[model samples]
Target chain A: MTDRAFAVVRAGALTSVQDRGRPGHAHLGVPRSGALDEPARDLANRLVGNPLGAAVLETTLSGCAVRPRCAVTVAVTGAPCRVTVDGRPAAWGAPVRVAAGAVLDVGSAADGVRSYLAFAGGVACEPVLGSRSTDLLSGLGPAPLTHGTVLPLGPVAGPPVYADAVPWQGPPRELVLRAGPGPRTDWFTARALRTLVTAVYRVSPAGNRIGLRTEGPPLERAVDGELPSEGMVLGAVQVPPDGRPVVFLADHPTTGGYPVIAVVKERDLAAAAQAAPGTPLRFVLTERR
Target chain B: MSTMRVLPAGDRALLVELGSGEEAEAFHAELLRRRARGTLPAVREIVPAARTVLLDGLDDPARFAKGLADWEIPALVSGAGSTVELPVRYDGPDLAAVAELWGVPAGEVGRIHARTPFRVAFCGFAPGFGYLTGLAERYAVPRRSTPRTAVPAGAVALAGAYTGVYPRSSPGGWQLIGSTDAVLWDHARVPAALLTPGTRVRFVPEEG
Candidate 1:
């Protein structure tokens, strides 16, 4: 093991390396797969004094544990989670030093579905297309972390940023998405549109990096035949044959055949990433800004 | 020069609705030409699909939409663009079923497929996978009733009015007619996808 490498002690349920995803590749049928909670990932990198685009570990509801080959500064952000070093309690949002060969354990998220962890130096995995983000849909970048996996770390850029306090938002009790009318709003009945905005939906447990599937009143379509396959954008609220709206997330497909009634604002997607299953969801349609 | 509708896909993206896939392709090519000339700014991605082209990551989507409304779409000059030829072995499991559907001998399937030239209409389902159009309306077929659990990479398949090659192993419902060894996607290759929208494609069957 190199001095700047870490071995995974426990990989939890699902853990993958992520950064600012590979954009501008939709034309090649590639998805923009990156950290779902962009702000949290950015904050973790900032706390560790790493570049904003540095690759970090994105853990699912259950967190992970790693043992570095060398002492390093680390910060955990996103969902508030229990942090420990060799069974001793450690800081959650602030930078903390971990001795070489010591285990850094991140516990299950307290309230959210995902968490972000950043090292003093970013994960230096070989990038497939200028990014270390693991794309689940297209199978690009590094694979999800498994137990005993070793990851190389980049050179430390600078000392960690010491701060008295770091602002963090808790998981949304109700995921409210501000949406704008879209490419195929005319395909749905007027009552379906009304139901989309007025009805209450809950996040489906089947939701993953691909989309936030919802369970609610099935939307009725005015048109019968399927629309020709069309390009889909992030945050697109696509309604499939099942009629439930599935909001495209970071790892969403580049094209889809379903009608997209609206697109949620990109800013609100971070909260959507944290919204646990069964969380109420409401869509407020607004004029395109 | 049919009238086009530019709808707001989101705050940063504009979806232009063209009447047909050919129109969408022409519009996409025009946008790429304009982008090459440095006229389009803050344009992140131009994704051309069956009947619409989505322009994403623009600084001002509304302003761009206004410009697109006035932009004239050029005629597509077929045979003037790049073409990728793929060599195939006609030994797919569904070849007999597809031949039965067409009421033709199984051996005639490969010849019929290779005779027609295909145009990449759009790409989706997976990376580097292009939905090619060329088959006549009579050849349009429905997807298999049950999807396969694992379709091998490079499997040449057809569904509806489109034919496509599996970029990688994935579950699919398309009727498999052959297999190819050509690399569809490679990160090391420039323009990773072998088939991009507007590119022409030809399939050549290996002689027994």
Candidate 2:
């Protein structure tokens, strides 16, 4: 009998199983922990003919190496990286067949910070709250992959979708995020608001799944006292006492006390995820729709 | 009557600001009522916090914002919801310290806690951990100067106008006063969180 599983050879940096994530449980203090690069994950799954909600591996920075116990179709997307099967070059952004016991290696990203690897059947893991995405903050779902981890793979669903060419967008040299006024915009000083849009910022190395912390001119506050802790939203550009802006991401806390000066449009956050540490960032203020 | 301020949280959600925690709880209850009646559209989450209720993952936030203007805010009594009794054994490491801060006997600490009816203000910090209110203003205590590396699960703890039970073992700073066997969170349960927003709770002291 053919075993349907893959053994992790090299789990580079941080790799974990991710899907669309559990969203409706914010009231239960659960973070919406999903693939940071949603389009990439979706594309990877689509190329492999897997359902959009099928669980896939999300690799950070350095990519991972896996050996399937059974033959499977695989596709790598998100960051442009080297994909190889048994030391032979494989296609990135397109489906490639991997024979059983062949080592499938996804190399370190050339320009982006994260990559998505989708197998034909998808990584089948026990779902917590209807999601396989790992919540780093809450320790929900499967833990980050380690060497020697054997992950089960679901049976192939359908034929892989073959495209003439798959367009891959390279990581931005200067990340441009569209910002709209936040609920607590009044908390910041007028000059600080101007600085937020005018001054150049860099992606802080300290950024994690929780938020995209920025290193730039601090936004001075107009309000003297702390705002009571209130529910926070994704893309909120929250400013702590340090005066720097921290764009809340998928794993952001359900509630926070700091004031939010602006919120980045959700569409632009996919690019923010690929931005490497110290990538130049610019906030473009836009009128609310 | 205080007016509710509907503010944009993001493109997808709105934060409705209320005057107090009680008002936030009341608004959350009203929203839940509207949802149950099918009057409110599908929303991903209705999260009530200190002074606001965040309506997240709305299909159309702009349209919903307009609808919120005409929605009537209902007056509700705090702790009016069904109550869940949690039996706790008061033998935490922070019991003596919490008792010292209140200038009461260690035995009296559990008595005061059990006497008060606590309403779930909001759930945060951890899954199924409810930040409950209803303790007197005098019981408002500061968090420990240094947080413990790891607080055990089922630890009934208190800090800054809120008393909560540790749903699962994790690092926490709240001063522990007791421990309970009642499950605060279970994924297999219909509603994973035992304590949700607007649920009233009672901490019953037990002899261990």
**iRMSD, per candidate, in listed order:** 0.8, 1.1
* lDDT (C-alpha) at residue A45 in model 1: 97
The residue ranges of model 2 lying beyond 4 angstroms of the native Cα positions read none
**Tens-digit lDDT string for candidate 1 (B1-208):** 5568888899889888887777888888898889889888778889999888999999998788777656777888788679899999989999999889888999998889999999998898998999999998788888999999999999999998899999999999999999999999998788788999888999988777
What's the TM-score of candidate 2 when only chain A is evaluated? Answer: 0.97
Each prediction's whole-model lDDT (CA): 0.92, 0.90
DockQ of 1: 0.86
lDDT of 2 by residue, A125-159 (tens): 88899998988888888999999999899988989
Q: For model 2, how does the per-residue alpha-carbon lDDT over B1-208 read when each residue is reduced to its tens digit? A: 3568888777788999987777787788889999999999889888888889999889998898887777777778754789999999988999999999899999899999989999888988878989999898898888888988899999999998799999998888899999999999988788889999888899888765
lDDT of 1 by residue, A94-203 (tens): 99899999999999999999999999999999988789999999999999999999999999998798889988889999999999997889899999999999999999
The weakest ten consecutive residues by lDDT in model 1 chain A span A280-289
Q: By summed lDDT, which 10 consecutive residues of candidate 2 chain A come out lowest?
A: A280-289
Off by over 4 Å in 1: none
* Candidate 2 CAPRI classification by DockQ: medium
How many backbone clashes can be found in candidate 2?
A: 0
Which residue window of length 10 is worst by lDDT in model 2 chain B?
B71-80
